[model samples]
Target chain A: MLLQIIVNGILKGGLYALMALGMSLIWGVMDIINIAHGAFIMLGAYCTYWLFNLWGVDPFISLFLSIIFMFIIGYGIQRYLINLVIRATIFITLILAFGIEIFINNLALVMWTADVRKVQVPYGASNFSIGCVTIPYVRLGAFFIALVIALVFYFVLNKTRTGRSIRATAQDLDAARLVGVDVAKTYALTFGMGVGAAGAAGTLWAVLFPINPMMGGILTLKSFVVVIIGGLGTMFGPIIGGLTLGVAEALGSNWFGTTYENFISFTILVLVLIFLPKGILGKSE
Target chain B: MAQRGATTKKLILGILIIAGIAIPFFSGNFIIRFFTNTLMFAVLASAWNIIGGYTGYASFGNVVFLGIGAYVSAVLMEKGGVPFWLAFPASGFGAAIFAVLIGLPVLRLKGHYFAIATLGVAEAMKALVDNLEITEGNSGIYLPMMNLSVKAQYIFFYFMMMGVLTLTLVVTYIMLKKKLGYGLIAIREDEEAANSLGVNATLFKVTSFALSGFFSGLAGSLYAFQQGFIKPESVFDVGVTVKMIVMAVFGGIGSLLGPLLGALSIEVISEILTNYFLVAHTLFFGAIVILAIVFTPKGIMDIISGRKKFGINYLLQNIRDHRV
Candidate 1:
């Protein structure tokens, strides 16, 4: 039972951590919380759903189109609306994020109404059984993709020059200016990258969960919880945080009968704020 | 006897209070009920300002304390068969303890994390309350009351809201007098600098959060008492949280009159529009919030204080950084 639960949690956590990675990137490097991160994910899921249903596109093939579509939207949004307040206070940025979130939700309600959409791929729910544990294929595939993304992000930030400039600007824009990097482009790129990650997570989420306009609210909260527990800006923090949170939630529901499951993350969030302000890992990178 | 500005403020407040108290008399039963809901929301918005505006913590979880207060009052009144007056304080007690417990951790995280933590706590509380048997679960619980009337409820609820708003302003005035309030402002401006300057950032934040929680709980109890109904969805609501934060931000964070002015004026406008246009009220309010943030990032106080400089400065700043 323990092994099965642990495995289930790890699979879910990997995907959640990937979502957290997108959130953490915008927060850590871009210095904007991007409250609309989950909305972008919702949009991506819808995009994937339509492509799979209408165009005979597989989930994996449609992932590329979703990324491309989201990248343009993300870049345009950041360059136009978000950059206006890059020099403003964090409060302004927060409001901007919220304003956009409300706008998107309302727009989506007008366009699509409040219906739930499902993305049913071939054998979407197929699972393998081993020693009394069931592992779903789609969940496993999502986890594999999340791992791949994290590894690629790790390599880009660790070894590349543009990544170096992003790191430099995140640390200190003034210092980065002296070192000759386009801070504006870097910020936009970081935001685009964050949204791209959101797209990937949305595809995964579309496979397992139902999608709606306001679905972003809960995912946004989950990402924050994952980000907080993992610590800000830490590449591997989301992976650790996501797994811990997923398992703890699973355990909480098991022990306290699901009523306390939501409370567990919050209780842990409160504890993290009080005792582990720097996050559980005490590392950002 | 005519103290001019003071008398003017007192006159406006008196008229607003009278109008609020006389709401059920002027409108239909449904309108009366809706106005009551708006007034309840106003009280919540004002209570939120005590900590959010003053301390700058951006607590996205203020609804949790509201839930605590509502649950406490409802449980005591319905389950324990306590009177309205006594049950109200029971609500406060629950909120106070919850605020302290949750605030201890959430208040420590800075910036976005603090906001997210509060939101998580709020959402978590809702889910927890939803499944708890004591609160009657997702099906909801009905209040056992002794003749609850909409008119009588409005009169008392008016006083409740007016009283909390007055208390908030008075407490704010008192805090701003000495070094304690200044300590909070210092932390808001720069936490590390404030700490270096001998301000105990932790204590101040935790205390302010508790104070905010206490009053929000008070408002919640008043809400439950007035409605004779309490539910986890409305009590610990995300929409309520957003409204509070938006109200504070729209008026002028860090100012006493700002939140009150913002809540009352915005709500009054919403009420008026809803009276005439009904369904358009939500979309209109949404637009107002967006416009408020875009045009006046510093809020109404900033516009009022620096009316002459608004446009010129906006243009100047944009021109100076033409990278736009």
Candidate 2:
């Protein structure tokens, strides 16, 4: 029973890790909390839902389309709106992002009518059992995609020229500028990539769970919990954090009832924030 | 010139105070209820200003105090057979103690960490309240309604909320002029420097948090009694915190009159928008927030105080200062 629970947790954790990746990038690079991170994810899920329902495209095929569309929107938001208050107090940026979230959420509500949506793929219900453990094909597929995206994200951050420029700017804005890196463009690109990751995660999320405009709020809080537990700036941090939270929440719900699920997550978050400010794998600043 | 300006300021203040006291008597029930609701928000925003604006700790969990206060007062009145007058003060005290207990450890963290930690606390508290048997396990609790006429009830709550607002403003005025307020401001400017200058950062931060909690609790207690019902969803709602913070920011953070002005204007504006646009009001509100932050980051107080001129050049300068 425990093994099956753990497996379920691991599957869920993979997606949670992917969800936190975009938020972590934005936080580490721009020093903004990106309160609108989950809004972008909701937007991505809607994009995938529309593509599937309208054109009958498979979610897997439309994932790339969602990413591209979200990237452009993300890029524009940062370049035009967020950049205007990028240099203000941290709370200013926080509030600004919050405004963006409110705007996006209300817009979604107006357009989508607060309807819960799901992606009904052909193999959504197909599951295989290995001994006593059952694994849904859709969940397994989502997990695999999450892993691939995380790997690709890690590679891009470490190996590419644009990645190098992004790192340089994150490290020292003036130095990066002096080195001929266009700081504004680099910031916008970083934000775009972060939003793209959110879009990809949202697509996978729609496959596994129901999607709605209000879903983003809890997800944003959960992503923050994952990020804090996983540590900031490290590639593997969110993965580790996500898995831990997933397993812990599963165990907590099992023991204390499902009503305590949020209670458990938030309690863990506070304890972690107090005791392990840097996270489990984070380095001392 | 300075003497004349001070005299005029005092004259305006006196007139506003008199008008505030006389408002409920002259206004109808609808207007009285509207202003009372406005007063409640003003108190909330003013409470938030004590910690978030003056002390520079942007707590995202101030609603926790509101929830705690509501529960406390509800339990005291309904379960303990306490009167509203006694239950109200007890609620404030209860929230203050909770603030101090949680603030000690939580205030150690800085910036976004503090905000997020507070957010977690509020969520955790809501969950706790949801599961607790005393809170009726999310079915919520009801307070004893006062045996009064409808007009009398309206006037009673209005005066109650107005009195609380007056107390908040007066306390804020005195605190800002005293050493404790200076210590808080010093901490806001630079905590490390304040600590080095012999200011106890932890004590001051916790104290400011407690003060903020105390007033928020009072507001919540009144809110519970006025509504005659309490629920985890209603009192602990994150939306309440957002409204208070936005009002504080919209008026001007760190200023005495900023939150008051912000709360009054925003509440009125939102009410108008709700009446006219209905569904699309929030969308417009979101846009207003975005435009306000982008254009007037310092808030309306700066413009009113003439510290920042409201013009094209000023707006352009603000953008230039912060834009990438």
Candidate 3:
């Protein structure tokens, strides 16, 4: 039972980490809460769904094209629209993000009409048994891809100049600008990068779960929980937070029934907020 | 003299009150419903402003109060068999009581922490109501709306709404004149300084949150009873609470009249737009949100008061202030 739970948690944690990675990147670098993040994820899911249904593209291969598509969309949006009120208070950012969420959701509604869409691969039901526990192929594939993305993210953030610029911007915007950094382009790039991460997560989610316009809100909240739990702004935060929450949720559901599963992340968020806001792995020094 | 300020306030109040009393008789039922929704929102915005505007504490998750009020009143009347007259107030109080109780712990966190905690609570409420069997989970229990007349319920709620709005406005006005309201404004402007000045910061903030929670809960109950059914999606909606905050900000955040005006104007504008062009309604709202923030950061109230006149030059000034 424990092994099965661990397997289930790791798979779910992969997607959570994928979603939270974008959130962490954007939030850590740009200091923008990016409330419309979930919508971007939703958009990614749709792109994959249609690409699969229409063009017979597998979810994994479709990810590259979806990432590019969402990247451009996110870049255009941030540069043209979000940058307009980037100077306002945190409250205004919150409001504008909400407005964007509404607009995106409505746009999705117009296109897809709120139908729950999914990527129906031939191997959705296929799995392998190891010892006494069974593991699903899709879940395993997702977990593998998640590890790849995490490693790539670690490489880019640490080894690359643009990634360093993003990190510098997150740490101190004025200092980065003083050193002749083009903060606007960096901000846009970071946002696009965030959206690209969502696209990756979306493809994975579309295969494992279903898609809808409303999925963004919960995903956003979950991302926050993951980021908060794993400690904010750290590249590896999502991996730790996601695994902890996924496993905790699994245990909670198994014991408290599926109904209580919904409250698990929220409860963790509140407890973290109240008791240890910096999170378990939060850096004090 | 304070007399002059009082008189100006009184005259404005007189005109608004007179208009409110006369509007129902003058308008058709459709118009009445629209105004009823606008006024109800006004009450909500006013309630939200007490916490968000005065205290600088943004609550992105207040919709559950309405849901609770709705469900409490709804379940009681629908299942426990209470009458509307008894049910609605009970529902409102149910939320109010919960707010005070929860506010005890959650309100201790400062700034964004409080906001995030409130959001967590709202999300939890959504999960709870959707999952709990006693609330019938997601199936949604039907209120006994067929037995009552819609217009009649509308009028009763309108009056009730007016009464609540008046109460909120009056209380806010009185508090603004006293140390408590002054302390709240000071806190919003600069909490550190306010604390230095010996303001009972914690007491006043908690009080304001409870007050805001109470009226919003009342409004929520009324909203539910009028709608004839309750659902978790609508009740625990972050969007609705955020809309109230926007309305308050758009009209003016710190003033009594700002929230009322913001709610009415935004709702009316969105309704008209949606009525004419349903597809572009959200687009228009989004545009307004962006424009309102970019241009009138202090809200339309300030624009009307000549604090910052809206024009090309004002736009330039805003860019100067906000551009990174």
Give the per-residue lDDT of model 3 (tens digit) for B1-324. Answer: 445555655676688789899888777778778888888889889989988888888877777677788888878888888888788778767887888777777877765567778888888888888888888887776787746476676677678778878887898888889988889999889888999999988787888887888788878777877788778887788888888988998988888899998998899899988998876678678777877877776777666565444688987786567666
Q: Model 1, A96-188: lDDT tens per residue? A: 787777776666766677899888777986899988889998888889989898888888877999789889988988899888898878888
TM-score of chain B of each: 0.85, 0.96, 0.91
DockQ of 2: 0.86
**Residue-level lDDT tens digits of model 2 in A145-207:** 888988998999999999999999999999999999999998999999999999998999988
In the range B41-149, model 2's lDDT, one tens digit per residue, is 8999999999999999999999999999999999999989999989999999999999999999999999999999999999999999999998887998888988999
TM-score of each: 0.90, 0.98, 0.94
lDDT string for model 1 (B1-324, tens) is: 224545655666688667766765677766666655665565566667766777777787888888889888888888898988798777777787888887875676777767877887788788878888889987777776556465666555666765766666677678778676898888878889999999988888887787788778888887777767777888888878887778777777886666666776677777786788654456566666756665566666555554345576764454344332
Please give the range of 10 consecutive residues that has the lowest summed lDDT in model 1 chain A. Answer: A276-285
What lDDT would candidate 2 get against the real structure? Answer: 0.90
Highest DockQ model number: 2
**Listed models, DockQ each:** 0.41, 0.86, 0.57
TM-score of chain A of each: 0.95, 0.98, 0.97
Among all candidates shown, the one with the greatest lDDT: 2
Candidate 2 chain A: minimum summed lDDT over ten consecutive residues — where?
Answer: A276-285
Count of backbone collisions in candidate 2 = 0
DockQ of 1: 0.41
Provide backbone clash counts, one per model. Answer: 1, 0, 0
Q: List, in the given order, the native-contact fraction of each candidate.
A: 0.37, 0.78, 0.54
